[model samples]
Target chain A: MVNQQRFGLSLVALSCLVLTACDHNDNDEPAPMPPADVSYSYEVTVQNLTQGQPLSPVGVALHGDAVMWETGMPASEALEVLAEGGDNSDFIAVEGVLASATGAAPIGPGSSETVTVTVVNEPDTFISIATMLVNTNDAFAGITGHGLSELEVGQTMMMVLPVLDAGTEANSEAAGTIPGPADGGEGYNAERDDADLVSFHPGVVSADDGLMMSALTSAHRFDNPAVKLTITRTE
Target chain B: MKLKQLTSIMVATGLTALSGFSQAAELEITVQNLTRGIYFTPILITAHSPDQQLFNVGEAASTELQAMAEGGDISGLETAVDALSADTVANPAGGLLMPTAATTTTLSTMDGNTALSIVAMMLPTNDGFIGLNSWMIPEAPGTYTVYLNAYDAGTEANDEIRGGGAPGAPGLPVPPPLEDLVGNGGSGVTSEMTNATVHIHPGNLGDDEAAGGMSDISNTVQRWLNPVAMVTVTVSE
Candidate 1:
């Protein structure tokens, strides 16, 4: 009788297990499935070429059909903030960005950093990267709205980028205005005291160049094509 | 005899069709001043043969180039290129191309003339001019953009004062539009042409004092970076 009882209980348990699985299948709603994984990756390496200026944390973005800044046009507030303050948070978060990456730390003069970004199957995307020359008020260097759709995996593209004036702040180089280690005074003041249109940077006029109030020296001076960028599509 | 004549005529037609390598190109060229405060005097755009060059860096400027760089004169260079059978558009802007202004002209380039060059003087400087030297025209049909830099003709000392526009003059030639805008100088900046060959300009050094500074140009207003102008070429065969 005991053996028969054990057998009966085993049969009941098996029936319950089968019925529960059947009930789960027969339910009106099914569990949600995870989406497919499709990724396109790029590795961007930036080199700071200035003698005294340390570049801000580099921000690289992949977008479609947009320019972050243009010559003769007013800079967007995001660009102004980055140009003035050496901050890239707001710039990277600007709308219409598909994928983005930021360097972990500021790149010092002659130093380099690599930041990798991944997007979902966006092989035909335009890439823009920007970083501020930390010694100046509104000088930044990068390429904007450059087409990278033709760059295939394993192919590398290299460019020497020219410095551009954001035209948001005057290049006063005053003692208490520069944000770099040379001054350590201020960054990202909201005043638009200079020409509001973007242009190639005329370069900084340091104290050595007869600007009385400038805190910068001749070592802080820089010319065109301030930075070099190397980009490779990974996967 | 009739069949042989027909064959010869077909052979001639085939040979004519295969000789399409020297086709002419129609180009619409536009130059836009990208400076904030500088002005470009009358421009000279030319399409010439590959072996010819209006100006080359590291070489001394020709007298014709010096004339144009100092005085905004294109007639001398125009005459020289005309002798070479080049297609040219002289003074497309008709006068000074002001800051951030653009001017366009069309030219039909003849066969074997595949290079394009452009030159225009930048005002308020002794001999600074925007130059595009011997850029090869593309055979494909498309629009191409090029950025140009400022070059010093090394013909005159950059004495930032008012003076004559002659080829050997020392001071900047202040036009009527720039008379009051430029300053009066107490003394000249320097009486030397250091490089004495066509090279990149060292840019202007204008002080804030309008009447008594070493330079008459404005330090803040008249300064510019490289890539002073943008040229676009639209080509169609």
Candidate 2:
């Protein structure tokens, strides 16, 4: 009688297990899936290497495939704004920008600033940074669309930046036109003057060099490689 | 598969032995002037032993190098390199390599010649020249590219005036083509070479006035930054 009673209890337990399994299959809810993994961040440090020219507030952006500027090509409207007036608003809001960061203040000559920007995406991303030499008419220095796919964790790359002219404005060195402390004048205008294609800057000819109406002096002059940029992949 | 691997090894060994037997190499070199306004004086391309240097930064220049940097004379440097049994080509362009121009030359380097150097004076300046210091030539047969920068010999003052081309001269040499471009009758810029050793050039301080100004160079035209020339070398197997 005891063995029969135990057999009956075992049958009841099997029924309960079969019923639970059927209930689970009949439910509409799906199984729990693994979590999605996607994210990236970079730390960029820009050092002003000039003697007297202070760089404007930097504009940093992360994108997938678009370039901010190209050598021997025309500067886009976003680049023109940043190069002329030290305003990075248009550049930060550019299309394809995954993330953007702007320095709180202008980086002075011989000083450095670090900016951090993060994006939640795959590893196939690029970073671009730009800033104007606020003392000059249209001179700016930065890099565009540097690939970050191979930047391993804790890896850093150092690049020397060459000065470029935004071709949207003339390098007239006229008074009341420069936007930096050298002139405190107008910044960006829609007018397209000079060569329309971006090219290496031919340096500024200050008033000391006979640009009589120029707000700049000999001290504002600069040379190639006006900025040093170091980028490190932190995460 | 085993036979294929053995054949590959044998070919590699044969090639290495052939390279060891052939000690001479033929090199085809092309140099491009990338600037828009600057003029490169007659260039001297030399392939010498590993011990020689055409120019050294932060060091005092030899008299031969000074002559080429201050003036557009390569005779001194040519003679010096020749004394070392170096393979050299002088003035491949036959004259000034104009702005945005290119010149090419071919040289056969004998055994023990392993390094290469090129030098050319930049006109409309006092002591500026495009320099490629001693660089090792790779033993592997391939093409290589090198960018050259302008260097100041620190031997003469950069007065930026128009005068003569002789060694130890006071001012720039007005070549025929550049005479029309350079200004005239300018007061001197300076008469001092502050750092009397090879250093980066403190670029030209030009004036706008074409005639009768503080500088014979046009501020808008005569200035340049680093990397004035691009050199391409093709090594024959």
Candidate 3:
């Protein structure tokens, strides 16, 4: 009798399970869907326009109204690191950055690099891009506080960038001062032995010019408008 | 636009619309010294007809221009531009614009004046001046930026000495601010004007010694890079 009673209970349970499965039909309202994620993306292309100067890995970031470096102000430590050494790691990681990207390798003279950075759910209004000239003491070429809100998808803007001295290390052109492949010397020294204020770079003076102690040659010299850059919005 | 008036009279005069007549413009201007150490003398900003040029590259500089370039004397240029009926802002900084500083001024141009020019002598160098030659003012109402480069007047020899302030002076003028800043007892940098035509300045070659060096200017104090001046012009329609 007990076994029969248990069998009846099992049958009731099976029917209940079947009815429960049927009650929850496909017609039931689907769980609320999540909102879609939106993204903004940009591509920064930099061309090393010099004849013999190779650029360090390109550093690019989306920032606010604040400038990365000013003409007369002292360079930040992040800027000093990239200017002295050919390292973009610290520059792209600077404070107040929204989104940043860096080129994979050094860009040679007459060569170019294009890097893309994307931000989720918001538009990037300002973009700052910088790259070291690699062949001098603390010289870099860049554009800062460039407004990108006006840039539409597939629209590109072009500008020529002038080289600037970082004012961190002295422009001695000594045998062991430069950190490029041309010199293979020390990089990112903490000493601020130079003018201590950022300014346009005086064209490199080589041993052939007047500085008899310079390790550089005339081939390393460069004039203004050192690089041509184009920024485009991909998304 | 001034040309609009000419266009209206073209039919009565039995002619088509003629070019070269420019519209007057109101401009709010700012000049910033971008150098880390260089100073600028009295700046003269002018707006004139397109035909007038204050200083042209690849040509010999005018004597008036030489006076201003050598001794920071803008009176000659001031008087000359005034004769042309050009609108001007003279010495907006009131004195020497120090390194990495700026000056602002406003100019209301007369009819048919559409070109802009700016000039200032860079101190601590002989015959070295910062110049912008005849940039056409765009008819559009917007802000524009231009960089002015250092130019050699090719009139006086850049002796790097402290000499007279008249025309054909042999050295740079040591203003009060630069009196103690500049060094003495230097022989000279060069005595020759190799390029007697207006040209991009062969940059100052300063020496390390404070006294008795090849140049009186300090290698670290007075040297500068090109594009010494940054000009911003906001045109209001």
Candidate 4:
């Protein structure tokens, strides 16, 4: 774990050096032109904080001033697809996106993945990333459009994020409903049978706990802060 | 540019003058229950010297803290903080703080009071309480936000059955709001607390059967993850 974190940090530093060199040369050639390409490279590392839940393919996006999802509001079709099916294509295709990146594969329990997203000409952009606990119905963890403008060079911030329910699907935990290895079931159905507004997930009710038809067990249950996210600005 | 510099200088001077006159500070605090279905008993909020602590992880709970954790009583903790000359605000909600509700209180710190602590029992549990232990108050004047997690006192069994509310109570206290929500008439979950010290709560093991199950708490509606409450504090110089 320690070695992985160190390698991730070094990659971020190398990217920043490249971006800084590009910005310095652009300053001399600009005249009433577009904004300088003050690029920023960010390394986002996520750790699964759950006992048995394995997260789906992670989605990372950089947007200007818009949010992907909000509480007490109807979820966008892009968000609904990702929440139900763990697909990142629709979510990454959202408008006003400055840059985006997706993890190569799903992250398992006690595992960590470091993704590097580089946005050009948008150093003051807001970063948002999310991944679903594929064992549950619609639980996802990520940060919204948190301001990254004040992040100094080589500075890092660590935070633990709470799980949120997309409110597009009910947390039934039934057979053939979950998309992870726990059930090997279908993903991304276009239906809004549950609460439509986003809210905090109340966790799964496994068979050991009382849901007789639930495919999940006590071992598949989880709690808050299902993921630990660390953001570092290299340039 | 000159006006900007002058404004900065005057602001610094005013801050210095205000710090000199006040030996202590008056704080306005607000705590919000962010969960959907948890109940917080009367809360115990205190500002004390750095030497004192209400509770600590991996340490045994004091008799006063145990009383507040096992049951919903705060008088013992209130008196303990009073003896230490700590500023305290007891039962700010006047009653139980229901789910998705908020409460506010005010506490004035003494000259040496530099640390803050808050504790409150969670309903439908034998020995669980929301805890914030001895956080150092910042010297700078600003608004700060802190999140609190549920801690097990480890002094009693979490049978989850409806029973007494006293300090040494064996089962959960079925308050009015939770009376219809929690289950009833079930065999106990466990009689032993493996770690006999304050620790992160393993969370409630609620069952699905409403009338008869191993636990009186409903598995779907009663369980919570960490960070059940949020505390916002505004400091004045």
Q: Each model's DockQ? A: 0.24, 0.15, 0.25, 0.21
Off by over 4 Å in 4: A1-35, A47-52, A64-81, A88-98, A110-121, A153-170, A184-205, A208-211, A222-225, B1-23, B26-28, B34-36, B57-63, B100-106, B191-197
True contacts kept of 4: 0.31
Candidate 3 docking band: acceptable
lDDT (tens digit, per residue) of candidate 4 on B1-237? 999999999999986775554357778898887554578999999998777999999999999999898878899999999999999999999989976577988888987787899999998789999999998877778899998999999889888888887778788877786778778798888887698899998888787778886888877657777788889999876
* Pairs clashing within candidate 3: none
Lowest lDDT sum, 10 consecutive residues, model 3 chain A, at A203-212
iRMS of each prediction = 2.2, 3.3, 2.5, 2.9
Question: What does candidate 3 score on TM?
Answer: 0.83
Candidate 2 lDDT over A1-235, as tens digits, reads 9999999999999999999887756557788888786667789999999988999989999998778886546789988988889999999889998899998899999999999988875688888899999998778999989899999889999989878778778777888889999899889997887666666677888888776667899999888789999999888
Summarize candidate 3's per-residue lDDT along B177-196 as a digit string, tens digits.
98877888889888887888
Query: Model 4 residue B222 lDDT?
Result: 72
Best by lDDT: 1
| Candidate 4 local lDDT, A6-87, one digit each (tens) | 9999999999999988775536656686656777988889899999988878899998866888654667888888888788
Q: After superposition, how far is residue A189 of candidate 4 from its true place, in Å?
A: 6.5
After TM-score superposition, the amount by which residue A25's alpha carbon in candidate 3 deviates from its true location, in angstroms, is 22
Q: Which regions in candidate 3 have their CA more than 4 angstroms from the true location?
A: A1-35, B1-24, B180-186, B218-225
Full-model lDDT for every candidate: 0.87, 0.85, 0.86, 0.84
Assess every candidate by TM-score: 0.83, 0.69, 0.83, 0.75
Instruction: Check candidate 2 and list the clashing pairs.
Output: none
Candidate numbers, best DockQ first, in rank order: 3, 1, 4, 2
